[model samples]
Target: MGIFDVRKIDCHAHVLDPLRFPYAQGAAYRPSGQEIGTTDQFVEVLQCYGTEHVLLVQPNSGYGPDNSCMLDAIRRYPGIFKGVAIASLDADLSHLRDLRDQGIVGIALNPTFYGNDFYADSPALMEKLAELDMFVQIQVQHDQLLMFKPWIERIAVRVLIDHCGRPTPEQGLAQPGFSALLDLAETGRVHVKLSGYAKFAKTPYPFRDTLPFVRALVEAFGLDHCMWASDWPYLRAADRQDYGPLLKLLDTLFPDPADRDILLWQTPKRLFGFGA
Candidate 1:
């Protein structure tokens, strides 16, 4: 572990391996040719950045609800990794209990990509998540934040917002989507990850355009309500990016050592209930 030896945990990360798992049949987008990310590969990313633990978020590429790869990582390294399952609103809930037991902390929901009619609050989906004691990880458009608000309040489990809510910089701090996210954070039950900035950037390189929006999230949610993710393999990213530069950008975003510690590790530990 490099400078990240300070008890850091990567709140959000993805494992993309099509050869081994095979992309979701006829999926919207598939990585051209990526190898399976085994436990060792994940560990290398963490160690290279000094991240001691990580929360594995299910990618939209493999929408099959087959979380075998994510589960394998957790099982192989019980203490260092945790998983978030990408669940289909159409699937059976019984399968969730075993995933929960296998260290799956939540369900990754992507309504926009999958074109689902059930908004976050759909009574049917809520019932399923509640049954297994899992949280809901949502990837909603910056405008859809309000749609999930009711569900967040009604669901017994915590709700995590993905990729800064994919906010547009023009929306600034007052964007209804970002505003709703702040409101959710105030409730203390919602968490947001400052991952996927690449998706929100307008131009190239640093995606510096999203700085104000990112800062607003950190300020509104505070360190405890926020977490960091590498969004590995740079999938669905608007621009080509490397993981090393991304980590450096994060260091710049949270310059203070304490804030960095919380964003990188401590808050994630508390959020996912992961051990140091």
Candidate 2:
């Protein structure tokens, strides 16, 4: 089967419908024009690509601690969507449980937005996530992963690192943060997203610079622990990145259908409990 024809899931994407859900009062960066990806538009993208399901990740760009938009989409599309919400640092246990009950499988902690110190209390939040069986999704760049390493080491929460830890491509895989990300795989509690090449790739298109790291991540984390994602709507994209090319990249990275099966379907379903 063709790559697009193959069964798959969009492991990372967002829903930004300002018409229905207005941006939060104090939202730092409001997505506009091409950046806006409404729930209906996203559903169409999935349909066009023959994607089976998707994980609706709440970007830190808008809609503060409120997850009404994502939660509402989950309710509207049960069995086909899962959410990774953004909760405040002091999110109480009950509130978390409520989110989980309503189809939120995890929470997003974006260091790119607040920097490392923003996650100072992450360890405690991680403990709660562990108890509730939710993944702690982290987005960091360069040496930022190192800031949370000590905390991650102390906690046993299931970790989902975004954008292959958003590594520095020129630095190679041995860079401290990316290296630490590779090391986390050994703990058997961490998973990394094999997407977001545009976020760090020095070049465009095929993103050749990121292939070596992708190889390293697949080798270290194995196929089951590494899943595919498309930072869809190509938000804040440096160049003209799109959804099709993102999936096509997998063909170059993984020639075998079986391996794609694991990365595109099984791994995400296993980790996020999609369709459950």
Candidate 3:
């Protein structure tokens, strides 16, 4: 069967345009490598794989609150892209309502990329996000769960844990990150992407080392709230990876078509509010 028939939705992807959205001048940001950080490049790759839609996540490389490139992409190709913008705790989200109306549905909380202080809650930030009904996507190391749990609980918005909480594959299934993930699942207040395993794996291609941890996440969150991603451009290793192989790997993770459908299609559709 073709990858298009895979019924896929790439839950984590980024567009890097230093010209339009310059690198953050602040110490909190880092420059994305020259390769694997283009909106058009990502679109071409996604279309090649028959991804029905994609959630354009904000990468830490372009850490500033500005989302011009991301928003422009969605505006240019509305049918193919949905967006998740990232903002710091100090950001003024007053304009989010208009952005939300324009298909910007989520904001990322990147404590690991910025600093642990970014996860600290601001009543105004929470109030603005709640008003817009946006999802707050958190990218935190597994051990740092306690740092953001209280804020997560206080927010009325939907929560998405980036990259299975960026758990280390070597941690196996019993690490604090995984445990925190399970506990969060018990509350039914969060969703985790089955993406970015490449980032956490210790070995080379064929990152089978992550199988046990990936399996445990599936068991804990089930098929409904779990989704797949390519982490495309593959960031640091963009040259070594592409969307096709990532989809192939995801198929191995889910196996059964019904479960695969949820991971690849259904769950993201629900979580990201993709239109049928």
lDDT per residue (tens digit) for residues 37-85 in model 2: 8888888888999898888898777786778888888899987888899
What lDDT tens digits, residue by residue, belong to model 1 across residues 1-276? 333456677767777666566677777766664424545777887777677788888776754577877777788899888988876665567767767888998888886675446553455665677676677888877687677777777767677888889877776778887788877776777788887877877767577888887888778888888888877767655556666787778666877787787787778887778873
RMSD of each: 2.5, 1.0, 2.4
List residue ranges in candidate 3 displaced over 4 A: 26-34, 91-93, 122-124
Find the 10 residues in a row with the least total lDDT in model 2: 59-68
Which 10-residue span in candidate 3 carries the lowest summed lDDT?
A: 27-36
Q: What are the per-residue Cα lDDT tens digits for candidate 3 across 1-276?
A: 654576678888888877766776773545555543777877777767788788988776654677778888899889878888866566666667767877788778776765776555545576677766787787777577666666666666677888878777666677875777777776676888887876777776568887787788788888898888878766666337766777777656766788888788888888777875
TM per prediction: 0.89, 0.98, 0.89
Off by over 4 Å in 2: none
Best by lDDT: 2
**lDDT of model 3, residue 76:** 87
Worst 10 residues of 1 by lDDT: 30-39
Please identify which of the two predictions, 1 or 2, would achieve the higher TM-score against the true structure: 2
User: Model 1 clash pairs?
Assistant: 9-265
